[model samples]
Target chain A: MKKLIMIFSLGILFLLSACAGENSASGNSSQSTGNKNSEAGTKDGKQVVTFWHSMGGAGQETLNSIVEDFNNSQDKVQVNAEYQGTYDESLTKFNAVAGTDSAPTMIQTFEIGTMSMINSGNIIPIQEFVDKDGYDMSGLEGNITNYYSLDGKFYSMPFNSSTPVMYYNKDAFKKAGLDPEKAPETFEEVEEASKAIVKSNPNMKGFALQAYGWLWEQLLANQGALLLNNDNGRTDTPTKIGWTEKEGKSIFEWVKRMVDDGTFANYGTNGDNMVAGFLAGDVAMFLQSSASARDVIDNAPFEVGIAFLPYPEDQERQGVVIGGASLWMIDGKPKEESKAAWEFMKYLQTPEVQAKWHVGTGYFAVNPAAYEEDVVKEAWAEKPQLQVTVQQLQSTKSSYATQGALMDMLPQGRKIMETALETVYNGGEVDQAYKTAVQQFNDAIEQANKARKK
Target chain B: MSMNPTLETNETYMYQFERVKKSARMKSFIKGMLFLFPSILLFSVFVFYPMFKTIYLSFYLTDAKGSTTVFVGLENYLNMFTNPIFLQSIKNTFLFVFYTVPPTVLISLFLAILANENLRGIGLFRTIYSSTIGISVAAASVFWLYLFNPTMGLLNKFLEAFGGEPVGWLTDPAWALLSVSVTTIWMNIGFTFLILLGGLQSIDRSLYESAEVEGSGYFYKLRRITIPMLSPTLFFVITVSMINSFQTFGQIDILTQGGPANETSLIVYSIYREAFVNYQFGSASAQAVVLFILILVMTVIQFKLGERRVHYQ
Candidate 1:
């Protein structure tokens, strides 16, 4: 028994030391890796700026090239970009690293996270940096900046801005005997065209819509409708969602009628499925982010056309809200490092870099001057589908509703909206679904407010 | 050198011996601890610490950064219980378990029996039966996602050929949970089959031979000899399958995203959404604690029930 006890205790001690060694070794390795980059930058008295972003695939490649160009443009700073998964995941990680020494100097947060990041009090408003440096802000697009600003002051720099657009199979339209070049500009026209397409091919769905909340939000904005109270959550905290209003009901009822008529297929909440449907010729047309234009063009078997997101016949188009992410400089970092990050941000907004980004990734160039760049003009001349997104942004009406909703619980609100949409699509009563979703949103906002107070 | 050396006293000798024994024991104890230290430390750091932290955080309200700002004892739990979504998630989790466990055990047991035969090419059959075990949850879910696609999926195509309508395998709430459960059942069969096969191989051939000699039919022999002997493996498979079904997330995330009116929203998915999406770490931790307790109670019940019915022989 004594011998057994001795063995057990010895075993425990061995485990303890092993764990300690492992932990320290990991710590050393991470520290060494971090030190290597900063060391290179520090040797030349250059500030090192660490940037965390959520771009992946080709977008990541383009972003890396842009960062490389910025690093080589001058000797004052070195920028290192890191891919940190999806937008939601990146924001979650950013929040987790807040107050920690390991926080990145800069982060790219999705547009929906704007209010949350602002409320966190962990970021330096981009407007402050712009004012301090007296940077040329006139070159940036007014509409893109409108989404990122609060009361005419920008909080973050718009990086990869996108708006929802209609993607259609040109061949499908031709087969249905509809004018291939003429795209539907109103919801009623889209419904009528869908019926013609379905009548042409029984096996094909006339239209498919992704059940994403962003799409619904964009629809509301196009109708000049608010998503939340307090003027789209711009002035103060929103206590209730605006989805119970007439515009919201009309959107739901339109979708339900489409589905009921077998003209529209609901692909659930994944936007990729709708994109896939359009590419595979299973659907005549679909609504998706302009950012997806590259993927669709690369994969679609037929000619694809892009058009503006449809609005109701009676409601004037108020433009769609941006769908992508923006760059926010983290607070509490060294002032020089923050300035270095700001310089990189400025580089990203230059006409040449923005043109490269727009041409490469199919995202809207935040800088309006980028459209005049040779690379951008040539790419648009070759693929005019890219020009449609630019035109949509330029033509959008500047209004509080069009500026987009600002809510700390926007992610949760979007999730609830998607759930309510799914409920309606599944044959549940629209009023019941909207009521339950709104109540949940109100509860979430209340809880968030209470937590913020604490 | 030893000429005038006195003999040691008995008490002194015994005392010296006791000291030497004590020292040796102490050295061995240190050695044992040294051997076990790494495992104990790892478990304490990765498992126990996180568990204790979860319990502690369950009582506090957390902010966007997941920092605890205020403590409201049991408020998180109370709110979770009152939330209809949470209650629905609990029900859905239970439904997933009920839909999965029995079918998994029965089908795998049947497959194991078929594969346990001493025939040529049995290895190939066993390999075929157990191939799904090699596929990770993410990979299997992707495969199922394609198979569940409403328009172009193979499953719907097969159904359409049988004169049935193309059902929305993933879209309709009525069929979403069942669809995900089907995928889970398919994934679990490989593991359960392997366990049951091992159990079947271990059962003595004499028992079955005796039953055969008594002119028992195949069903009779299976029920009387094979089943009773396979009770232990069945118990293990059921317990593991139950636990796995309760924690199902990847498939639900990929295939349905806990959607179609939250029909497939299990407890683990709810906890994830609460923590990551809503940044409600306190409520998420509370949900986690509840899940932990539930799993513990379930495991205890399984063990207690198995103790009575599981035949060691």
Candidate 2:
């Protein structure tokens, strides 16, 4: 018994010491990594700026190359770009590290997270930095900048911007005896073409849209409708949702009719599934983000056609809001780090870098000057479909509706809207679904306002 | 030296005895403490600390930055109880438990009985039945996602072969919860099968032989002997399966993301969404505390019920 006790005690001591060793080892490793950030700039006499972004795949590679170029441009500053999961995840992680010394010098946040970040009080407004340095903002696209600005003050640098567009399978259109060259420009034309496609091919769905709130918001924007009151929450924080008004009801009715007529496949809220459905020939037409053009062209078994987002025939198209992310400098970082991050941000806006980013990743270059670059011009000549997104943005009018809604609870509001879509698709009454969704949105807004007050 | 020899020897002997006893006791006490120290330290750090912190955080409201802002004092719990989504999540969790536990227990027991028999190539069948145990929740869920895809899925194709229309297994709100439950059951069968198989092997063959000698049929023998003898294992499996069903998250996340109007949103998934997605750590901790209490109540009830029926050798 004594021997057993001794053996047991020895085993426990070994385990305890092993755990201690592991804890200390991990602590040392993390400390070493942290030290490297501080030592990197001092070692080479260059200031180091850490950038946390959510771009992946080709976009990440493009960002890395841009950073490399900036680092080589001068020996004064070195920028390190790190890929941090999806937009929401990156924002969440940024929030987790906000007001902490270990926070990254810069973070890339999506357009939807704009309001939250603005209210976070942890960001150094780009307008401030631009004014302080007298940086030229005249070359940036107005439509993209308008969405990120409040009363003409931009908070973040619009890095990669994208708008929603119509993607049609040209092969499917040909098989259905519809015009392959002409894409639907209005909702009525889309429905007519869908009917013809479905009639020709009984096995295929004529159209499918991701049951996402962003698409609904885009539709409302195209119809010149506000998503929320208080000047789409730009001048003042919104206290109520404006989605249950006339335009919102009209868009909802249109979607309901499409679903009822078997012209639209409700692909839930997953964008990838909707894209896959279209690529697999299960659907003839798909409405998705312009950023998806690269993947669609690469994966589709047939020619893919891209066009502007469809609008209601009666209302003039107001264009779609940008859907990608932007870069923001975190406040409270060292002055040199912030300056280095700002320098890298300015370098990213250069025509050469922007054109490379635009051609390599299918996202719209925020800099209008990027279109003048030979690389962008050549790419546009090769694939004219890429020009449609630029034309849409260029033609857009800067209005309250077009500026997009700025609400801290927009993410939760989107979920509520998606729930309403699901309800309506499942044979529920459209009016009731919309009413319930609006009520939920109002409740969420109230809660958000209360929390913000606290 | 001046004392009597007998008195001196007795005194010395008593003193030596007491000294040895005290030292041995002290040594053993220290050894016992040393043996328990690691587990105690780990449990305190990982389990107890988090539990206490959750309870403590439940009374406060956290800001968007995850920093505690104000003490609300049961307001979080009250809000959760009144929220429709939270109530629905509780219902969905119970429904999942109901859909999965009995079927898992019965199917695993059936497989165990089939595999327990001495027959040609029974080992292969046993291995086949237990292979799912090796598959992680994530890998199994991804495979099930393909199976549950509404279009271009193997499940729909199979249905189409039978002249039935394709069903939206994961997308349809009516079928989403059940679809997730099916995945959970499939993932659980392997572990449950192994446990029941152990129970089956441990049941003495003499009982079955005696029953057979008495002209009892297979069903009668199973009911009279095998079931009573395996009650302890059955009890264990049911309790574990119930707890596992309540805590279902991975399959729901991979298969449906608690969607189609939050039909498959189980309690744990709701907690995760509230905390991580919405950054409502206070409300999430409150929900977590409720879930902990619910599971504790359920475990106690199971124990109480099992005490009545679990037979021991």
Candidate 3:
């Protein structure tokens, strides 16, 4: 009798679920909700486009205002902007729709997924789009432009790009008897400093690298680790992984030392926790995306110092990879929608907007033109900390480590490396784990590739 | 009609056969609708339709130029099982279930019995015992993670106050799964407690009195009368708990994230990583199917074992 009732209730529940509306993946679908005026294109033969991005804060507001300006200025094209969730979620959701022909006209993708998006053939090549629309990207930031292009073909419109930097707590450093102004310049120095700082103050920690393998990847790239050996540096073939090189070994050794010493901890394995620990004075230093500086300064209880990542012992840096995402244009959207999206994309690259984004959030302005403009120069003139990110941008070069990795199983690879690090850090063998992980990851890649083949 | 008994008999036999056939058909139809309703509705809405679509899409390659999905079958599943990460995920899931299920079942049953006393302020005790149910898994996991922080968690704080060194609650590979299981047990105890409580309340008082008349003590009475009588509810709770533990995702996602060496990655969490995170929907669906079968087998085993113990009065 009880089991009958159980079956009966479950049946009813299932029936009801069939009628219930689906979850619209709430995060991305409504970030920048605007007035729903028309499902139709623009009036007077104009092209109306829908653009989606996850840029929030002043940058989001600025993008909205620019869109409104574009809508007002051109009767030929009306741009409607929408906000998706963070870059990663947005790309995944976009692909699900894009797997069919129903994709947003334009969507944002992280730098890591750029080659994958290009290889997928679903997104429109920006070079083609620009050629057809006759839009010049000459006014955009020169360095920002460098990261977005592939083989002289601009596949994405770069926006809101930032690099990772060290965020330190001055108060914790002072308590630990370490000079807050002098940042560690190498991995060995960081290790020794961390041990000293940890001893000096119970609450103070010397180092907390946010993404273990992710940081390692960056460090290796800056230390001249080639992410891929072929495919014209992430242009031709996409889906090759190269982590068994000298770079991989060094990174493992460095991380294993930190884990053994207990100076670094990431239970959730997220940068947010590291930031939280730093802000709460549990840790003295953090290496995270430069964009997070403002939020840390605002929420932090002590003076926060920002600095460059420690150079590897080899010392000749290959330059840092650009973190954050870019926007990909879809090929099949209505002309009006594509035009509106293009206009919105161009509007975000303007000097005034870039400068405001740089100042409001710690993400440096990508536009070189923005820095030369009086307004942008003046904004940074009084505030030099904001300039640190841009200054690093000057030293930044386009490399596989700092720029991106072109592997089909990177989303999977991240887990592989994370688990390997955790195991090694917890006193597991690094060499054995790496061999096992690489073989497993390659098998996964072969599987994905085979699925793709089928 | 009485003129010829044979004619009457023949007519009655045909009528009876027709009636019986009609009844059988109607019975089967109603029962079929009842059973089919849940599975069809759920499969169409949640599991089935999505799976059918996902499997259909497993074929074809994706590239920046375009996404072309061809019709492919079995390839995705074959690839998944062959992959070491996926295989390791399987091993880890089983390892977790091994540690979690037995401890949770035994401890929860004990807790239910202890709290079943007819004492003062029993309501307060019940509330305290079952309160964690109200907490969201994600929210509970966050608290659990903080508690397991090796350097400065509540667990370490207490341990240190006793002049003992801190143990890695969720950090060490050996301890990670145990730590996650501990949180799962605490969070879910309230649910099974309420189940056993209802069963305990429903047991007849007359039976106990009869046992007392027979000179049976509390232990003997509990072992003979209560255990046998409560077997049905126990069977149900155990089955549900097993299934729930197998599908465990929240704690792993939030607390350990299937780490300290994938020590806590359950099948469902792996499915999430494959489908949502890696965009390998086809492979993920295959995993979901495999998981569904594993749960079905376990549930069947529980029912088979239950038959011997259950007494339907």
Q: What is the per-residue lDDT of model 3 for residues A264-342, given as tens digits with 9 covering 90 to 100?
A: 6544365555676677677777777788766777788788877777765865766777777788888776666776777
lDDT of 1 by residue, B1-313 (tens): 6543345466678899999999999999999999999977877886678778889999998888878988889999999988988999999999989999999899999899999988999999999999999998889999999888776688988998998877878888888999999999999999999999999999999988888888999999888889998887777678767777777777887898788778889998898789889999899989988987887688668766775787776
Candidate 1 structure quality by residue, lDDT tens digits, A355-434: 99988888989998888899988998788898999899888998878889988788888888898888878777888887
Angstrom error of the Cα, residue B110, model 3: value is 3.8
Candidate 2 local lDDT, A1-454, one digit each (tens): 3234334433433343233223114334433443467446544778888788888877888778888888888999888777767876677667766776657788898888898998889999999899999998878888887888777888999899998899999998998888899998888888889998999987788887777888888988988888899988987889998654777777677778888898877678777777877887888988888877777877889999998888888889887777888999899888888988898899899999999888877898899898999999998888878888888888887888988999888887887888788877766788998888888788878767766664
lDDT by residue for model 3 (B1-313), tens: 2458887899899999999999999999999999899867757767558545544555533332224454456666676777666787888877777777777777777878888889999989888888887988888999888888765578988998998865767666778888988998888888888888787778898999998998999999889888777877776677667777777877887887677677677887887776666666666657766776676676667666765667655
Which 10 consecutive residues of model 1 chain A have the lowest summed lDDT? A15-24
- Top lDDT hit: 1
Q: Give native contacts recovered, as a fraction, per prediction.
A: 0.48, 0.26, 0.36
Candidate 2 chain A has its poorest 10 consecutive residues by lDDT at A15-24
Q: After best superposition, candidate 2 residue A356: deviation in angstroms?
A: 1.8
**Interface RMSD for each predicted structure:** 7.9, 8.2, 5.1
* Candidate 3 CAPRI level: acceptable
Report every candidate's CA lDDT: 0.83, 0.82, 0.69
- What is each model's TM-score for chain A? 0.89, 0.90, 0.85
